[model samples]
Target chain A: MVPPDERSRALVSVLGTAETKVTFEDPRSIPEMVLAVVEAALEDAALGWHDIDAVVTASVDLFDGLTASSIAVTEVVGAVMKPETRIAADGLAAAVHAVHQIMAGAYRRILVVAHGKASMAPYWDLTAWAMDPIFLQPLGVNFLTFAGLQAAMLARHDPHAVSRWATTAALRRSAATGGIAGPISVDRVMASPVVASPLRAGMCAPVGDGACAVILGDPNIGDRNLGEEDVRIAGIGHDVGPHHLMIGELTDWAGLRRASQRAYTLAGVTKPTFAIVEPSCLFPHEEELFVEAVGIGTTAPHSPGGGLFAGTAPVISGLSRLLRVVRALKGRTGERGLAHGTWGPAGQGQVVVVAETP
Target chain B: MILESTIRLPFSYAAGTVGSRFLIALREDQKILGARCTSCSTVTAPPRPFCSSCSRTVTELVEVGPDGTLEAWTNQPGNGVFGLILLDGADTPIVHRILGTINPGTVNAEAINMTPGARVTAMFAKDRTGRITDIEGFIVEQDDP
Candidate 1:
């Protein structure tokens, strides 16, 4: 894992990024969603489907309720005859895998699209089914339960934790102008119905339907419209934590911390600072955990524009975080940033990407 | 109109050699089994053939607790309380339901202690089946709080 820096000149660039506004429920189907983002991303990159050498998609069979979930978007993603790889986890993971293709000198351009419709079914039940059917599943518990467990553990020590988490949720929701999750005052948040003990509905990111698409291209070889402030992926890192919540450290995102260390190593920088940082924190407490894990002091413009509290699709949350970082860095060029993504109960899985202006 | 349909696929999972023995011990003798990894010296309840930490095979099955300490627990609405119990002689905690009069109607706070490090014992179901549920749930043998 070498940083795509001086040692490796064949680095991957974010040619384009586009995503539909995360909503309570998208009226369009998966294919239509793919088509919309594909067109917008292609337009942004100044390229067409023919320019993309391969397609890497992020979707899950269980999430889509369709076997081989990628089949639905095959035509729209322009993967008719080209090579395609599907990642069943977070959307950012798909981009991480696609970067490998470019770094290996295989593909010049790869289109990464991740879509999810949380409105399709009861999302928590699906996550519960993802657990070990032997022990955890029969208990009828899901990710929310784990979050509650973790929160209770955290709050047990810190008397002010629940109130602080409520304030964090209210602040994020108020900043979340995307309209996916309506804003609520701190008092209202405190009064919000509990989804699980300690974790109220107001504290959770209102998951809904949305899709995110990004175009990753070999910066060295392509009719690349080399923009001066273009933000390219300098380093990529991902780690899978132990599946059992009991076995792993629950209070902090140890997996994300490890992934960031790997990324910082690959980026060739030991002590790093960023102008922007985006974390795929589905819950408010997670934002605090991610901030502490990465050691990025909470003062930076972290998760500008409300982060996941603005509303985001599950599988695409991490990739969506990357999109936010890319979009943010585009305006304020020549600055470093990090994007984080996590999956499974209590952040048992994590991925991080370090991006910077070239 | 939104299309709504349920996708159902009935399936059965074969708990491999280690898991089978662990379940069988509970069914036949009311004994709890755990595997100690030779390489890592880590004990895993609801034993797996392979150690999750070191990826090395743990074939030595040892009789583990009918008692353990509650590492953590949560009260999931609509679902009863669940806890991660670190059985005596095991490093990893096993997640299971908390048994006792926990039904909301009779949920005696004093009877059901949810604090971490609370001592509990495995209670076997009278009607034993070869499943994790064979042990109805862990009872509060000694409430820490």
Candidate 2:
């Protein structure tokens, strides 16, 4: 029986990291995307495909333009003869599900991966399907439109909301530079056209192509754990709010608060002190909302560089946050950290992970 | 010069366990079937053979009443309105378009316009065939008031 409160005795580790080989013209296919993530996980875990027990992947079928997108990429994950589950939400949601399997005493040494290539389809048009068909979709709403709603709501009270969001966008775009596209300046962001009222095109995360993977195991294995360094997944929690406009409070995210409370309780964290905090901030306004929802003190380091605005790959955004937090924890300056991820329309769903150096 | 590269994605789909069968059954019977999970005792509309909650095999199938109450409803000015109707015999709600009974303009006017326990009934097509569209949509049961 899988207890809802069963703490994860199984510690998950991050291994070799390789992203999709992206180009303006020829981006990596889904199969190739899966292969890239598989190689990274196998190398990082210091094991071969023979060592893997089961696989849990994160993807949305609509985004992939294929029904049961996992089926197409399953072979490349090397799960030909193994158990696999696909999470329809964000990458972090998939990671959370994988942690449950480990703690349930179901299997040991599981692989969790997520990949997204936003270049394939029209992201805005596609995201419309995620909204409540009657209320939101008819408004022609997508993530950008939702961000506009959130931004406009905030701007109504604080006139500086637009400027602050623009500044945040400039910062992240500059940080994301050396990757696929180059950097942007505050002036450039200010000059960009408004995609939604109050939210200029510059205030959003750049759609990109990438894949990520993590290897989790029953901590009771070997002399130590799976990865060269032991990184324990202390707590995991996710929640979905009522799918309606009237019920959801536009100014506050009660769902994120509930999710974090549950996660902190499992991790046994009373005081959240960390050198790093990574949030899946798709828009600058969302970054503010996230920091407020998580109850992070002003003193706490928040998205040290920039968040989704830097580079975000839909389903992989949360895993990317995890990767950022892991890198921070690996560095000697880091101790405990938090990674936050969200999906659905207007942050209707959320997941948080609290991990500490072991 | 503009370079247009054609992309084609071809793959066989499951038609989903419930959605595919619902189409066939709707064509033949004009009655909707409910998938009842033997384990949790949950019923899904336009039935499937498996329980989503328990992931257990559905043991029984039953025809739901053509009559149900509007649990919630909404409309789009130019598009359409969708509602969740809680059928008389089923536990879960079925989502469908609310046809002539509710005005599309008023539906989209505000979210609070939808009230729970509001009585509504299915409006079937005159020709009578088994298909989701066979039930043209739901109509407000004005005879009760």
Best by DockQ: 1
- State what share of the real interface contacts each candidate retains: 0.43, 0.00
Query: Tens-digit lDDT track for model 2 on A1-358?
Result: 1233333433454443444543333355778777877897678667789887899988888887776896678999888889998888888888899888877878777888888877777777688767654224433546555555556556655767677778878777777645455577778888987676566667777777778787777776562334434566777879886454322344677888889888878877676665678999778878777877888875566776566765668788887788777777763322567898898866888999986655
After superposition, the stretches of candidate 1 with alpha carbons farther than 4 Å from their true spots are: A1-10, A298-301, B100-111, B142-145
DockQ of 1: 0.54
TM-score of chain A of each: 0.95, 0.91
Tell me the tens digit of each residue's lDDT in model 1 across B105-136: 34353466556677877878898888888988
- Which digits, one per residue and each the tens of the lDDT, describe model 1 over residues A1-358? 2233533322578989899988888999989998899999999989987999999999987888887886798889999899989888899999999999999989989999999988898898788888888767776778888887777767766888878989988888888885687888888888988887678888888899999999998878745565766778878889888777754578878888888988877776566578778889877788888988887777756876788988988798988888888887885545677898888888888899998775
In candidate 2, what are the lDDT values of residues B1-145, reduced to their tens digit?
Answer: 3334544665343535565556556666677777788888877665656774576888577778688876544443343445557787777666566664444333222333334456766766777443456666776654422
**Which predicted model would earn the best lDDT?**
1
